[model samples]
Target: MSDPNGPTVRRRRLGGELRRLREHAGHDQAAAAAHLECSTSKISRLETGQGLAKAMEIRSLLDLYGVTDESERAKILKLHKNAAEVGWWEQAEFEEILPSGLGVYVGLEYDARAVQEWGLGFVSGLLQTEEYARAVFASLPLRPQDEIERLVKVRMQRQKRLTQANGPLELWAVIDEPVLRRPIGGPAVMRAQLKALAESAAQQNITVQVYPANKDVHPGLRGSFSLLEFGPADPRIGYVDSPSGNAFLEKDKQVRALVATFDRLRAGALDPEESATLLNTLAAEEN
Candidate 1:
C-alpha cells in the first residue's frame, strides 16, 4: 500500500507539531527564531510547512519549546526526516508547470480521502478530459502550445489517485450547467468530454451534480473552490483560485463557511442520476 504520509503531508505534520510545541511553551516565532539564531520569516516558513527544517534546527526548536519527552522528540525528528523526501509532483516533468500554490494544493489533495469541489466556470480538473483540458489551457492568453500540453499531462496524472488501489479519492463535484454547454474545444471535444464525464460519474468513488443555470443566485457564485478532507484526524482545508490570486484556507471558520456553501450548492444542484442524464443529453446533442 502506498503511504499517504508523503513529504508534503509530513512537512505539514512537522510544522503543526512545531507550532503546537511553540504555543505550549508560551514562546512566539520571535523567541523561537532567537533560540535558533534564524530570522523570524524562516521560523514562520518552517511553522507553516512552507520550508523544511534541518534536524539540528528541529532539535533546537524542540529545546526552545521545552519539549523533553524523548519519544515526542523522536517523532518530531522522524517527521522532519520524512519531510525532506520528494513527492512525484516535484519531479522535473511537472516542476515548471505546477505553480507553488497548486503544488501545495496537489500535495494536500493527494493525502485527502475525499474532495468536494464546486466548479463555477469550468469542469473540475479531476473530471476534465485531455482535449478539453488542452482547449481550456490554450484559451488562456500567452500560454504556449508546449506549456499547454504539459499542463494537460499534469491534470491527467492527478486523476490517477481516483483509481489508486489502497485509497481512491472520493470526488463529489458540483459543476455549473453552462460549463457543459460551453463547447470549449468545439462540438467534438464537448461530446468526448461530456461522455467521459458521464462515465466517470458512474464510478463508485465519484459523484457528479449539475447546477442548473436558471438558478440565478447561488452560494458558489463567489468563485470556484475545493474542500479537501483528510479524514477525522486532520482538519479540512479549502482551496480557492481566481483571477486575482489563489489561496489555501486552513482556519476552521473559513473552511466551515466553504463547507456550508458547498452543502447549499449541492442541495440546489441536480442529483447524481439526474446529473449523469444531463451529461448524456449534452453529449448526444453534440453529435
Candidate 2:
C-alpha cells in the first residue's frame, strides 16, 4: 500500500537500481561519483535510499551507465516523483519533537502491509486505546503533559492504518500473560483496554496470541520485537527495544533472525481463538 514510507521506500528502490547499474558497469562508488562530478557521499546516499535523487541526476547516472531503454528510464523517473511526496506526519510541525529512531519506525509502520509484534511491556502501540495510551505516556516522566499528549495523538493517528480506506494493515501480535494482566492505567483503563484488545483480535486482519508466563524458556524471553512486512518489492524491517538500547534492523540477517523468532513465538503462544478467550477472562476480572 502507498503510505508514509512511500517516499523512503521509493528512494531506496531507486537507489538499489542505480547501485546495480553502477556495479554492472564496473564503476565503483568513488569512480561513479567522480564521473558524475558529485561527492561520493551523495552517490552513497542515493544508492542506499538515504536521500532523494533529482530527475536530471537520475537521468545523468542512467546515461553514464548506458541505460538507453526509454521504458526503464521512465519507471525510474516516476520513482523520483513519488519519492518527493511526503506523508501527513512529515507535514506536522510536531514531528521534530519525536525521537529520530521512533520517527523512522512510525514512517515504516504506516506503510507496512502487516505488522508482527511481540509485546513484553504494555500492548503494542497500534492496539493502545486513548486512556491507556495517555497513562502509559504519563509514566515516562520525561516529556511534559502537552508533549505526552502530542505523542499520544500521534499514536492514535497511526492506528488509523488498521481501519483506513485502502484496507486494514494486517496485525499479528503476541502478548505475554503479564501484558494482559497488568493494570497500567488503573482498573478502569486496563479493563477497557483489554476489552478493546479482544474486539481488535476479532477483526479479520488482526491476530492476537498470548504467551504463557509459566513457560520455562521461550524464544521471546530474549526480548520483545516487531517485524514489519512491507510490499514484496520492499525489504522487511525489524525493531527491538530494550534497556540495552533500541535498534531498527534492516539487514537481511538481522531481520531474518527476528522473523524466525517471531514465528517461534507465534507457534508457542496460544492461538487467536483461545487468546481471545483469555483476554476476555482477564478483562472481566479487572475491577
Candidate 3:
C-alpha cells in the first residue's frame, strides 16, 4: 500500500511506521481510531499512505501505543513533516504539463542514487542536450507547441539531480548505435548532442556506452527501461515508459529481471573509453 515513488514518499514511510507501531501495541484500526477520536477509515488512509498523517495525530498514536523512546518519536515526527512538504514536480509550474504517472516517476528519479538505463531509439532523457530534448518533444506527431516547451523544461530540470553538490547521482546509460546515427534533430543537433554525450562521458559520475549497430541483436530489442537504485534513505524504483505513459516496477522479482537485463546490455555494449572515441568521431563526421 505504500507508494515510495511519488510526492507522498515521506508520508508512505511514516504510514508504514505508524502501522507497525499500532500492530505492536495490539491495537486494531477501530481501537486506534477511537483513541484518536477519528474514523477508522481515516486511520486506514493514513496507514496506507492514501492520506497525509499529521504530527499531532502521530503523537496521539505514539501515546496510545505506549512508545516512550524520544528518538523514535522524533524520527516519526520528522517523516510526518517531510510528508507534508511539496515536491518540485507538484508545484504549479509543471502542474498541467506533467502526466500523473510521469510525475510519480520524476519524484522517484529525484531520490535515485544510481540509474542504469537502456535506450534503443534515442538518447535517454538525462543525457539529451537541450537541443536534442527540444527536437524530440517537437517531433511528437500532435503535441502542442506550448506543451513541447513545458516537457523540455521538465526534462532539463530533471537532469539537475545528476549534478548536485553532494555525491551526485551515478548514471550508466547504454544507447543503441542506430539511435546515435538517427539524426534526431538533424545533423547539427545530432552533432551537438553527440558532443554533449562525449563530454558527459568524460565526467566521473556518468557512463556512456554505445551498442554497436554491427553487433548481433541484443536484449534491449525488447524495449527501453531504467533501473533506479535509490539511496538507503528511499525505496528503490524501476521505470518503464512508452508513448502512452509510464509505469513503476517496485516488486523485487520484476526489478531483479530488469537489473539482469541491464547487466547483459552493459556486457554487450562498448566500454566507456571506446564509446567516447566513437561519439567524438561521430561528432566530427557531422561537421
Can you give the lDDT of residue 181 in candidate 1?
91
Q: Which regions in candidate 2 have their CA more than 4 angstroms from the true location?
A: 1-5, 27-45, 54-74, 243-245
TM-score of 1: 0.94
Per-residue lDDT over 201-244 for candidate 1, one digit per residue giving the tens place of the 0 to 100 score:
99999999999999978788889999988856678889999977
lDDT of 3 at 61: 94
lDDT of 3 by residue, 33-99 (tens): 9998889999987986557766788898999998999999998887887788777877887867876
Q: Which candidate, 1 or 3, would have the higher TM-score against the true structure?
A: 1
- In Å, residue 252's CA in model 1 sits off its true spot by 1.2
lDDT for each of the candidates?
Answer: 0.88, 0.85, 0.84
TM-score of each: 0.94, 0.85, 0.79
Cα error, residue 254 of model 2, in Å, equals 2.8
Cα displacement (angstroms), candidate 2, residue 252, comes to: 3.3
lDDT of 2 by residue, 76-101 (tens): 88878887877667767557767665
The window of 10 residues in a row where model 2 has the poorest summed lDDT is 1-10
* Candidate scoring better on TM-score of 2 and 3: 2
Please give the distance, in angstroms, between residue 241's alpha carbon in candidate 3 and its true position after superposition.
Answer: 1.1
